[model samples]
Target: MLTPTGEIVAEARRLGVGAGAFNVITVEHAEAVVSGAEAAGCAVILQISENAVRFHHGRLAPIAAAARAVAELSTVAVGLHLDHVESDELFDQAAANGFGSAMYDASKLEYADNVAATACAVARGHAAGLWVESELGEVGGKDGAHKPGVRTNPAEAAAFVQSTGVDALAVAVGSSHAMTNRDARLDHELIELLHDAVSVPLVLHGSSGVPDDELRAAVRGGLVKINIGTALNIAFTGAIRAAIAQDVTVVDPRKYLRTARHDMAETVTKALRVLTGATP
Candidate 1:
């Protein structure tokens, strides 16, 4: 069933569980995520990122439509989410095309600018009846730590959420974006403190880097919406590589991609279970 992000994440929060938000780059990615969601009988968020939009040549309507269709047809509730969108126009574009929620990344800008831009985006999203999520200071990825060794301050996080009126907050506890290895260490104490200070559900970006045990602990600590990307990509690409290596002359795209999608589905299903506190 198709539902709003607020409804989906709220349930996870109420049940003391975490909701997995997977970044879908292709139709196969969407199918894999939906398949995983049904296997777990859990609600999942399908996110289309800015990089994906760029890869699709600045068009999200087609992909967004397909995702919405999948959500409606799926047995489990699913939310269409726009992830790491940095531009106001793109945010509006996604909301117009039918995204249930969007994360406006103004973390690169100055603190005041980040707050203002995020606040404006939040207003626009709320006006369109869509959920908005934003980050405070900048959760630095490979671009070097924001402010050289800073994590999200509980008071500051609460202030940011209160000021912007965002439905969710993505904080930099310790994980970095685009990490291929699941070895990033998270500040569990900060996660709990932020949870105590803020009223909204916390979001953990770049969750693909955190190990399975640490991820489960993060949810136990406070994280509600967890964003995973590279991990699934690894599964997809790994299968693709193996398929081609096994049959070098296999020129048919469908054969290799079909196997890849199945592999991705299996990995995603495992991740979803960990997020939902079910045995893997």
Candidate 2:
């Protein structure tokens, strides 16, 4: 069933669990994410990032349409979200194209400027009845420019959310984006502080850097939404490599693509289990 992002977040809040949001670059990715959610009997979010739109020549309609189709056809609840979108135009496009939620990222700008931009985006998204997410500080891995010690101030985070009226807040504690290793240590105390200070749900970006145990701990400490990308890509591509290596003469795209999709689905299922504290 197709679900709104706000509803998904509310469920996570009610259950005291973290909702997993997976980035989808292709139709296969969308299908795999939904399949994983169904396997876990949990709801999941399907996210399309600005980088993915750029990869598709700035066109969001096609991918958004495909994700919507997949979500509607799936048995488990699914929400479509636009992740880390910096441009107003693209954000508007995402809302128009049926994305139930969007993360307006203006973290590169000065503090006040980022707030103003994100506020405007929030208003626009609200007008379209879309759940809005925004980041306070840089969440690291922005082309390797993030400082290791940069963390979101709890007071500033509360102020930002009050000012922007965003539905969710992505805070920088210690995780960095695009991390290949899942060793980033999160500040459990800071997560609790932010959760207490902010009125909305707290989101953890660059969650791929945090290992499974740390992720469960983060959830227990107060994180609500977890955005994962690199780990799934690693699982997907690794399966493709293994498939090709296993059959040197195989040329059919479906043969290898099937394995890639299945592997990604398994990864998402495991992640959901961890985030929701389900027994494996």
Candidate 3:
């Protein structure tokens, strides 16, 4: 069933578990995520990033509509979210295109500027009946700048959430984005502190970098929303490579794409199990 992002997150919070949000760049990605959520019997969030929109020539409606269709067909609850949207135009487009939630990322700006921009975005999102999410600081690994030492200050994070009136807060806690290696270490103590100080559920961006045990510990410590992208892409591409290697004469895209989708689904299922502590 199609569910609102706020409702899904609220449920996860009530259950003391983390909700997995997977990035979907294509229809196959959305389908795989829904399949994984159904397999795990847990709610899932499907996210479309700004870069993905750009990849489609700044068009969001097509992909967003596809995701909505997938959600409608899904037996398990699913939410569509716009991720890392830095522009008002794209944010408005996402809301107009049926995204139930969006992340307005202005972390590159100065602190006060970020707050002001995010606050405006929050008001707009709420007016459109969308749950808003925003990041306080850069999480790292953006454009090849890997600053693993950077972390979000609990005080600043709480203040940002309060001032912006965002429904969720994504924080920097020693995890870097675009990480191919799943060995990132999260600051469990900071996660607990942020959870205690902030009114909204804590969102961990760059979660694909964090290992399974650390991800489990992060969720147990207080993180509620886990956003993953790179890991799924890795699994998907690996499957495609393996499929081609096994059948050198295969020219049909569906043959290899089927394997990719299935592999990606398995990865998402594992992530959901780790986040929700579901029995496999």
Model 1: lDDT equals 0.88
For each candidate, what is the lDDT? 0.88, 0.92, 0.91
Arranged by TM-score, best first: 2, 3, 1
Maximum-lDDT candidate = 2
lDDT, candidate 1, 79-112, per-residue tens: 9999989878899987688788999988878777
User: lDDT rank, highest first?
Assistant: 2, 3, 1
Model 2 accuracy (lDDT, Cα)? 0.92
Cα RMSD (Å) per model?
A: 1.5, 1.0, 1.1
What is candidate 2's lDDT per residue for 43-93, written digit by digit as tens? 999999999998989999998899999999999889999999988899998
- The TM-score, computed over Cα atoms with residue i paired to residue i, of candidate 3 is 0.97
CA shift of 164, model 2, Å: 1.0
TM per prediction:
0.96, 0.98, 0.97
Q: Please list the residue runs of candidate 3 whose C-alpha ends up more than 4 Å from where it truly belongs after superposition.
A: 145-147
